[model samples]
Target: MKPVEIAKGVYDVGVIDWNIRDFHGYSTHLGTSYNAFLIVDEKIALIDTVKKGFAEQLLRNISTIIDPGKIDMVISNHTEMDHSGSLPYIMDKIGIQKPLYCSKMGEKNLSRHFSSDLNYQVLKEGDEISLGSKTLTFIETRMLHWPDSMFTYLKEDKILFSSDAFGQHYAGHEEFDDVVGNKIMFHAQKYYANILLLYAPLILKLVEKITKAGLEFNIICPDHGVLWRNPGRIIEAYAKWSKQEDCADKAVIVYDTMWDSTHQMALAVADGLHENGIDVRPMKLRDWDRSDIMTEVLDAKAVIIGSPTLNNGIFPTIADFITYMKGLKPKNKIGAAFGSFGWSGESVKIIEQNLGEMNFDLPVSGLKIPFVPDNNGLEKCREFGSQLAKAIKG
Candidate 1:
C-alpha cells in the first residue's frame, strides 16, 4: 500500500497483509492491514510501525514522503508485536539515537521485545509533545487490550491515532471509512466481538473518559484496517457493544455431531425456536469458524450448544468452541446445552458448566440422550428450545 495523506501532512504509511487469513486464532477472511502513520510537521514523527516482515514496506512508504532519518521522533502506541514488531528495524534504519516515545508500560514492554538500549521517553495521560505547529496529546488507554496500549491525538489535525481500538482485520484498497462504505462495520463488529469483547467494560469506561475529557476528533486512525473519517460511527459502536445490551430476540444453536443424533437434535431445536417466533441460526461446528460463531453470539439473546459425547466428554469441536467463547466473554445471554452419548452422557453437563462460568442465564438443566436420539429424544430437544425461547422473551 502506498502512503496516502489522510490529513494535511499526516500520511498513512502502513502495509497490507492481504494473504493473512488467520490472526492468532481469529479468522481473517478479509485479511488485514498493519496501519502506521507518518506525521510530517516541522519535526517529522512516525506513529507506530508495521509487522516485522513488512518492515521494508513501511520504509518504502515512509521514503515516498521523506527520508527515514528525517523522522525526529518515533511513538510506540502499543507494544504488541503486530504494531511494534518492526520498531527495532526502524530504529536501526533511522538513527537509534532519535527519541522514542511511549506510554510508561510501553517502555517496559518494548524494552523486553528488543535487547538494544535506546532513547525511551515515557509519557502518561494528559502529556503533550510539540512538533512545531502541531501538538501531540497522549491518552493512556491501558488494558483496552494490553497494558501498553494508548492513543495519540494530533491536536492541530483533530485526528486521534487509536492504537488498536476500533481496528478491523480487513485488507482492502480503501483506506478511509467513507470509501469502504457499509462493509467496514461488518469487519469492525467481528473484530470487537472476537478481540475486544473481553475488554468491553474498559472500553466503555475509556469512551466515557474521552467524552468527559472533551477530546473531539475529526478523524480516528487505528493501527489496523481503514481510518475512520466519521469517527463517531465507531465510537458509537464501541459504546453500544461495550454496554453488553441491545440483543435481538434471537437464538444461535451451535452444535457438533459424531453421528446424526446430535445433528437431529440441533435441527429440532432450531425448528422449535422458529415456531416460537424467534430468529434462530443452527450452525454446524465443522462448517462454522469459532470466531464467526462468537460474532453471532454477540447480539443474540440466547446461545444453545449441542454436542455428541466422545469418550466420556464433549466433542472436541464443542470443547474448542466453548473454550473460545468463554475467553471472549459475551454478556447478556441465556443458554442451554444438549447432547447424545453412547455410554457416558457428560457432554451436556460439561457444556452447561462452561456456559454457566460465562454467566449465561441457564434456566434449565441440560438435556442428554443415550445412543442415537429417537423421536422421543428429539422431541425433548425441541421442548428444551421452546423453553429457552420463552425464557429469552420473558
Candidate 2:
C-alpha cells in the first residue's frame, strides 16, 4: 500500500504486515498493519515506525511525500518492537543527532531497547511541541497496555495519534472506519478482549479522565489497523468494553475431549443453556484459536469449561487455555467446570480452583463423569448447565 494522506500534509506511511497470524499469542488471523505516520510541516516529524525488516519499506513510504532525511524528529508513542523496531535505522538515515521525543518511561524503555546514545527528549503530561504551524500535545497513558505508551494529539487537525488503545490486528484494503463499515468492530473487539481485557480498570479510569478533559478527536490513528474516521464509534466501544459488563445473556462452553466423553458432556451442557433462552457457543479448544475463544468470552456471562483428565491433571490444552484466560483477567463471569475421568478425576477440581483464583462466581459444583458419561450422567450435565443459566438470570 502507498502512503495515504489522512489529513492535509499528514500521511500514514506505515507498512502492512499482510502475513502475520500470531501476535505474542494473540491470533491475528486477518493479519495486521504496523502503522506509522509522517507529519509534514516546517519541521517534519515521524510518529512511530514499522516492525523490524520493514524499515526500508517504511522509508520508501515516507520518501513518496518527502525525503526521509528531511524528517527533523521522530516521536516514539510506544517502545514495543512492532512500533519502534525501525527507530535505529530511521534515526541513522534521518540524522544521528535528530531528536527522538517520547514519554519519560518511553525514554527509559527505548534506551533498554537500543543504544542509549540516541537523542532522547522526554515529554510529560500536557507537554506541547510545535511542528511549525501544527501543535502536538502529549498525554501520558502509562499501562494503557505498556508502561511507555502515550498519545500525541494534533491540535490543528483534531487527530489523536493513539499508540495502541483503539487498534485492531487487521490488514485489509480499507484504511478508514467509514470505508471498512461495521465489520471492523469484530477485529477491534477481539483485540480488546485478548490484549486489553486485563487492564479494564485502568482503561475505565483513562476514558473518564479523557472525557473530563474534554478531549475531542476528529480522527484516531492507532499503531495498527484502520484509522478511525468515525472516532465516536470506537470511543463508545472502548467505554463499553472497559466496563466489562455482562449485559448479554451469552454462555461460552470451551472444552477438549480425549475420548469424546467430554465433548458429549459439552453438547448436553449447551442444550441446557439453550433451553433457558441463552445464547450458547460450544468451542473445542483444538479447533478454535484461544484468541477467538477469548473474544466469545468477552461478552458471555458464563464460561463453562470441560476437559478429560490426563495423568491426574487437566488436559494440556485445557491448562494452556486456562493460563491464557487467567492472564487476561476477564471479569463478571459465572464459571463452571466439568470433565470425564477413568481413575483420579482431578480435571474438574483443577479447573474449579483456577476459576476461583480468577474470582469467577462458581454458582454450581463441578460435574465429573467416570470414563464415559452414561445417560444419567449426561442428564446431570444438562442439569448443571440449567442451574448455571438460572444463576446467570438470577
Candidate 3:
C-alpha cells in the first residue's frame, strides 16, 4: 500500500503486514498493520517506525511524500519492536545526530534495545514541541500496554497519535473506522481481551483522567489497524470494556475429550444453558484458537471448562488454555469445571483449583464422570449447567 495522507501534510507511511497470522500469542486471522506516521511541516517529524523487516519499505513510503533525509526528528511513542524496530536504520538514513524524542522510560528501553549511541531527548507529561504550524503535546500513558507508551497530540489538527490504546490486529483496504463500520469493534475487543484485559483498572483511570483534563480528539491514529475518524466511539468502548460490567447472559463451554465423553457432556451442558434462556458457545479446545476463546470469554458471564484426565492431570490443551485465561485475569465471571476420568479423576478438581486462584465465583461444585458419561451422567451435566445459569442470572 502507498502512503495515505490521513490528514493534510500528515501521512500514514506505515507498512501493512497482511500475512502475519499470530501476534506473539493473539490470533490475527485478518492479519495486521504496522502503522507509522510522517508529519510534514517547516520541521518534519516521523512518529514511530515499522518493524525491522519493513525498514526499507517505511523509508520508501516516506520518500514517496518527502525525502527521508529531510525528516528532522523522530518520535518514539513506544519501545516495542513493532513500533520502534526501524529506529536505528531510520536514524542512520536521516542523520545520526537528529533528535529522537521519547518518554523517560522509552529512552531507557530504546537504549537497551539498540547498543548504538544516538541522540535521546526525554519528555514528560504535558510536554509540548513545535513543528512549524503544528504543536505536539505529549501525554504519558504508562502501562496502557507498555511502560514506554505515550500519546502525541497534534493540537492544530486535533489528532491524537495514540500508540496502541485503541488498536486492533486487522489488516485490510479500509483505513478508517467509518469505512469498516461496526465490524471493526470485534477485532478491537479481541485485542483488548487478549492483550489489555489485565490492565483494565489502569485503563479506566486513564480514561477518567483524560476526560477530566478536557482533551479532545478529531482522529485517533493507533500503531495498528484503521484510524478512528470518530474517536468518541472508541473512547466509549474503552470506558465500557475497562469497567467489565456490561456482560451478557452468555456462557462459554470449553472442553477437550479423549473418548468423546467430555464432548458429549459439553453439548448437553450447552443445551441446558440454551434451555434456560442463556446464550451458549461450546468450543472444542482443539478446534478453536485460544485467542478466539478468550474473545468469547470477555463478554460471557460464565465459563465452563471440561477436560479428560491424562497422566493423573488435566489434558495438556486444557492446562494451556487455563494458563492463558488466568494470565488475562477476567473479572465478574462465574466458573465451573467438569470432566471424565477412567481411574484417577483429577481433572475437575485441578480446573476448580485454577479457577479459584483466578477468583472466579464457583457457584457449583465440579462434576466428574467415570469412563463414558451414560444418559444419567449427561443429565447430571445438564443440571450442572442449569445451576450455573441460575447463578449467572443472579
Candidate 4:
C-alpha cells in the first residue's frame, strides 16, 4: 500500500501496521495503523507520525509525493510514543529548523518522553494557523483518551484531522464503506469500548464543542483506521459512543465458576436471553481474554458478571478483573450480578460493590445464588436475565 490520496492537497502518509502485535497496553489482536497525514500548500504540514520501527517507511512514502525538507510544520497531537515515536528520527531527516506545534501540555510531555531540548510551539483551544489558502484550527480535547491530545481542523476543506479520537485497531485492504460490510462498525465499537470508554465525559464535551463551534466537517481524517467521507456515519457513531450505547442488541454473560454450578447458571441466563430474541455471548472468566470480553461488552446492550465465592471473598481472578475495570471505568453498560457462595454469600455482594466503585453509571439489578444452582436457583438466574434485558430495552 502506497500513500493514499485523501484529498486534493492532503495525502495519507500513514503507515499500515499489519505485522505489529501490541498497542499502548492493549493487545492489538487485529493489528492497527499509525496514521500520519501530509498537507501541501504554500507551506507543507505533517500531522502525527508513525511508530518507531516504521519511520524509514514513513519517510520514503512522503518522498514519493513531496520532498521531506519541504515540510514546514509538524503537528504532534498526542505525546504518547505511538503517535510520535518516530518524531525525532523524522525531524533529523527533515531538518530541525521547522516549527513544531502542539498543546502546552503536549509540549511538556514530549520534552519528558524524548529530550528536554525538543520543545514545540504550544497551541491552545481555538488557535488557528494558515497554510496558503487553507486555515487550520486547533481544538483542545484533553483526556479524550490522553491528557495532551488535540485535533486539527482543515478550515477550507471541512476536514477534521483527529489523532486517535475515531481510530480503530482494524487492519484490512478495504478503505471505505463499499469495501467491508458491518465489520467496520464492530471493529470501531470494540476500539471505543476498550480505549475510549474511560474518557466518555471528555468525549461528550469535545463533541459539543465541535458542534457549537459551527464547523462544517465534510470529512474526518483520523490518525488510524479508514477516513470518513460520509461524515454523518462517524458523527452519529461518536454521538452514540459518547452516550455509551451498545449496538449488538445482545447481552453478555461472564462468569468464573469454581465448581461448575455457577457455569451452568450462566448458560441458563444465556438461554433466557436467546429465547427473548436477544443474542448472548457467554465466556468463562478463566477461559476468556479480557480484551475479547471487552470487545463483546462494547457491543452488548446488557452484561452479567459473576464469580464463585472463594475464602470469604470473590474469586481472586474476578477481583483482579474488577480492579482493572475500576481504573477503566467503562460506561453505558447495563449490568447484573450472579454468583454462588457456600455458608456466606459474600462473592455476589463483593462483585456488585466493586462494580459500583468502578463508576458503572448504568441501570443495574443484581442476583445471587446459594451453594448450588438447583431448580430454584436456575429460575432465579433466568429472572435476573429477564430483568436485565428489560432494563436494556428501556
Clashes of each: 0, 0, 0, 0
RMSD of each: 1.2, 0.9, 0.9, 2.7
RMSD of 2: 0.9
Candidate 4 C-alpha lDDT tens digits along 210-329: 788788877787777877777778777878776765566788887888889889889888777776678889888788767667777765776678888888898877876676666667
Per-residue lDDT of candidate 1, residues 124-221 (tens digit): 88899999999999998888799989999999889999999999998999988999999889899999999899999999999889899898899999
Model 1: pairs clashing at backbone N, Cα or C within 3 Å: none
In model 3, the worst 10-residue window by lDDT is 237-246
lDDT of 3 by residue, 163-271 (tens): 9889999999898999999999999999889989999999999899889999889899999999999999998988888788879999999999999999989999898
Give all candidates' CA lDDT scores: 0.90, 0.93, 0.93, 0.80
Worst 10 residues of 2 by lDDT: 238-247
Q: TM-score, each model?
A: 0.97, 0.98, 0.99, 0.90
For candidate 2, write residues 250-305 as lDDT tens digits: 99999999999999999999999999988999999999999999999998899999
Which predicted model would earn the best lDDT? Answer: 2
lDDT of 3: 0.93
Total clashing pairs in model 2: 0
Candidate 1 regions exceeding 4 Å error are none
